[model samples]
Structure formats: structure tokens, C-alpha cells
Target: MNTTNSIQQALFHRFDREQWAELRQSVPLTLSETELVDLQGMNEQLSLAEVTDIYLPLSRLLNLIIDAKQQRSFVLNQFLDHKVDHSPYIISISGSVAVGKSTTARILQTLLQRWPQHPKVDLVTTDGFLYPLADLKRKGLMKRKGFPESYDKKMLSQFIADVKAGHDEVLAPLYSHVTYDRRHDEHQPIRQPDILILEGLNVLQTDADTLVESRKPFVSDFVDFSIYVDAEESLLKEWYMQRFLQFRQGAFANPKSYFNHYSKLTDAEANAIAANIWDTINGPNLKLNILPTRERADLILTKGANHLMDKVLLKK
Candidate 1:
């Protein structure tokens, strides 16, 4: 017997786009086209159809899960004869860079909030927890910016723990894409929300380097549900290249942008540079770290070359 194949078959129930879209039956499309456009990431093609077909059903499933968890908590509290503060349900979104994780997170947050059950949904990206540029440079980890070691994992984990502990307010650091660094002066306050969506490249990663006797907790440990956005390596590279070229004219053009030096490059030059960065940095990180965490996710959203989800794999 093939153990690996058997385990996979038992673990996930696969659905094609059409099949998955059918699950959206009776789930109202709460987002307008204008709101969807705002939620779209650079070089991403997010449409109302995509939201209706992919995200609506996902939101519905999440709503159901949240409701079930809340009910279970209520039952447990009643049995214990004590009133306990309801903890926010945490949903984690993890994927390779340029795989549209942020867009997915934003869309889910919007759709989930529209549900009267959990109207207070908050979105937080792990980018903010990344070590500051100066810290990365000092630690000689500049090139490995998105790698697991590049983050202040302790602080990130503590923040999630505090939120899960039902803290009244938890402040999360903010990151500036233009400056390519953590904003020291600015922080996002996560008031005790009904649901919290944490999005990042390595949110699903587990540290294997920790000592066996002194194992540390991972961010995924606190996540109630986790999603992994996926695409072929070639497609991801293409999307990254497109986004990089677009940024040259957009964010990179700003004098305050960390990548402002690349703004003046011609299309060919920009593409060449983008390819080099992908080859050296993002590509390796995806292959070495992010992709390995795919199986750890509760659901995997696989995308086609057209930048739309083509398949859904949900853990059974």
C-alpha cells in the first residue's frame, strides 16, 4: 500500500473551480466591484466573479467554523459554571510572495465582516513583524528579508498569544512597502475583534532548529484555520516579475521608496533586475521554506496562470 497517497486521499477533498463555486449557493455576494478593485494587489486580477466563485464560499465555511467554535466554547463554559471571554478566531494565510495571499486575506476579511455573525474582522500581515531594515542589515540578513529568520518571531508569537488570550487591545507594528521597513513610530491597534486574519509568507512555518527539549511555539499554533495560496513556480515567477515592473512606475517612483533607484530603469532593465531578485531571493525562499508548509494548511487555494483560483483542497 502507498502510505503517502493513501494519506493524501484521506486528508483532503478536492474540488475544481466549478465544483467549488457551487458551494457558494445561497451565500450572498456582499462585495461590490469597486470594493474588490480596492482589495486587489498590484498585478493581481481580482474580479467580482472570482469573489463570488472562490471567496464567498470560503467566507461561508469560515463563518460556520467560527459559529461552531463559539457554540462549543459556550457549552464548555456552561459546564464549568463560569463565564469566559470569547477569544477571537484567528485565520492564517500563508504562501509564496506574489501568490496573491494579501488579496485573498483582504477579500476574506471584507466578506467575513459583512456577515452579521462576525462583523468585527481585523487583518494583520506578518510583514509588519519583520525585523527593521537596519536590524536586518546589522544581522547580515538583508538578502533574506522574507525568510523565517528575518522576523522577530518572539514578538510576533507574543502578539498572537496576547490576542488569543483575550487582551483588550494589542498593538502590532506596521510595515511600509515604500520604505521597505518596519515603521517604528506607527502601530496598528487590534481591538478585541471577532475574527483576526493574519497574512504572511511564513505564518505556517515550524521551526525545526529549536532544541527538542526546549521547543518553541510557532505562529500557526494559535491559528484556528490556515490557508496556503499556491501556484506553479513558473507562474509565481511571472507574477513576481510583472508586479516588480509595475512597482518601478508606481511605488518605486517615489523618492521615499527603498526601491526608488530601480524606477528609472527601462522595461528590459527592470525585468532583468526583477528576474535576478526572484532567482536569488524570493525563488529560493519559496522553494526552501514556504512551499514546504503547503501540506500543513487546512486549505490550499491553487491558482492557475490567469491569476484565478483553479482548485480548492480542503482538509477533511
Candidate 2:
């Protein structure tokens, strides 16, 4: 084995849009126009053409990987002459706040569920695992809501563990964006899905001290596959501000909204506030906690300013 060749092979396989589109294998569009409209986030750009060209192929690839994993598990069980339960295949999606991970997860879930073998796909956002708003305020971490310190890492780990163990049912707390807090009475139940799509800003983050020895597993440990959506920091900032302004017009306008005050703000005030929040909170969180995990993803989808997949890097 040549050293240089081995080193090069360890790196990723890069594909431009046209090259990646060639990988699509007749995976039909299952989602309708109405559903696509609902799936897209405010101010985020997504089109059916992009979905057919980019995501269809990605879904096909995931289906192949999932089938292979199942076959391997079957063979191993036969070799051992024992029954070992197969855990749900977990696919994680991570990126900066406005990098379109939510839309990606939703589209993937729909495409994946259309596959014959993996029908019970579910999408779960790690936002539910964030510490309640009161808890954050109590700990003086209000400004750091999206930071790692703001989440209950232990609880999130356990939730993944339970789901991986094939628990009959697992419940996750619900977080309300309108109220900007965890809902006291609502919960989302995971009923042993065939595949679980976990989407969030920090799904790929690991402990700071990776060299330390410990039995504790991070959330990514349960992921069978992961995707990191990527774009330039400046583009992300623009999208975040755009989304914030849209929210101010709609959700924030509700009298009961936690950010109701923002609805009353002038255009200049709203823009300033969005910029300040991004500068002080979301921007730093992306740099320090999120972007560092991009290389760890099984696949990296690099987006252009128009929110199209400009290129993809698949781990070799």
C-alpha cells in the first residue's frame, strides 16, 4: 500500500452538482407542492428542481447504505448463532441556524420513507433537548441559548440511547418557538422508527477533550450516518437576519409571543437587533460549537448563496 495513496483515499470524494446529479436512480418525487411549501423555512430558498437533482440521489445513497448495514447485521447474527436486535438507523443533520438543515431533514424523511424498506422514518430536532427557558435564565445563559452549555447533554444522550436500544416508545419534550420555551404538556413520542432523522445545530459536536477516556457517549455516537450542511459565514448571517425579520412580521406579531416586542420595532430596530443577536450569539455558536464538526459528517452539502447545493463531499 503506497502511503500517499492511502492518505489521499482517507480524504473525501468531491462531486460537483452535475456529477452528484448523475447518482440519482429513478427515485420518484413523492412530496407534493403543498407539502414542499410547508417544509421550507421562512426566507429559505428551495425548489423542486434542486430536490430532484440533489436530494433524490442522496436519498438513494442512504437507502443503499441502510440495506447493507441490515445485511451485515443479519450475517453477524447468523455467525454468532444468536439473535441481536438491530437498532433504528439514525441519520443526523447539522449546520448553522439558517443553513437549511431543517428543510433537508424534512425532504430526506419524505424521500426515505418512500423507499420500500424504510417506511417509518421520523424527524426530531435537538431543540427539544435545550434546557427550558427558565433554566437558562436561572443559570445566566439566556444569551447563550443555542450554545452547548444551554442544552441538557446528559438527557439528550439518554434519549438517543433509549431509542437505539429499541425501546417500545420514547418521549421527547417539545419546545415552542412562539413562546421560546419548552412546552410543559406536550411531548413527541418515538415509537421505534426504522430510521430517525435528527436535525439540529450541534448534532455532530463531541466533547472538547476527545482524548479523554470515558464510557459516556455523545449524541453522534448513535448516528449511523450524518450530514453537515455548509455555506459561507456571511451568507448564513444574511439568511438568519432575513428569517428573523420574517418572524417579526408573523410569529412575533402574536400578542402572546415571547418576542412580541420585536413585532412593534421599526425596520431599523429589527435589523439592528437581528444583527446584534447573530453577532453576539448565533455567529459565535456556529464558529465555536458547530462548524468544527463539519469534517466529521459522512456527507457534506455545500450550499451557494442561492441555497442550491454547489458541491458535495462524501467521506471515502
What lDDT score belongs to each candidate, Candidate 1 first? 0.91, 0.89
Tens digits of per-residue lDDT for model 2, 1-316: 7963364347789898999998997778887878888888778668888888899899999999999988898899899997867479999999998989999999999889999888999899999999999899999999999988899989999999999998989998888998999888799999989899999988897765355666689998889999999999999999998888899999999998999999998889999999999999999999888987888889999999788899998998
TM-score for predicted model 2 compared with the true structure: 0.94
Q: Residue 304 deviation, candidate 2, in Å?
A: 0.7
Model 1 vs truth, CA RMSD: 1.8
Deviating ranges (above 4 Å) for candidate 2: 1-10, 83-86, 209-214
What does candidate 1's lDDT look like per residue over 220-270, in tens digits? Answer: 889999999999999999999999989999999999999899999999999
Best by TM-score: 1
Model 2: worst 10 consecutive residues (lDDT sum): 3-12
TM-score of each: 0.96, 0.94
Candidate 1 TM-score, C-alpha based = 0.96
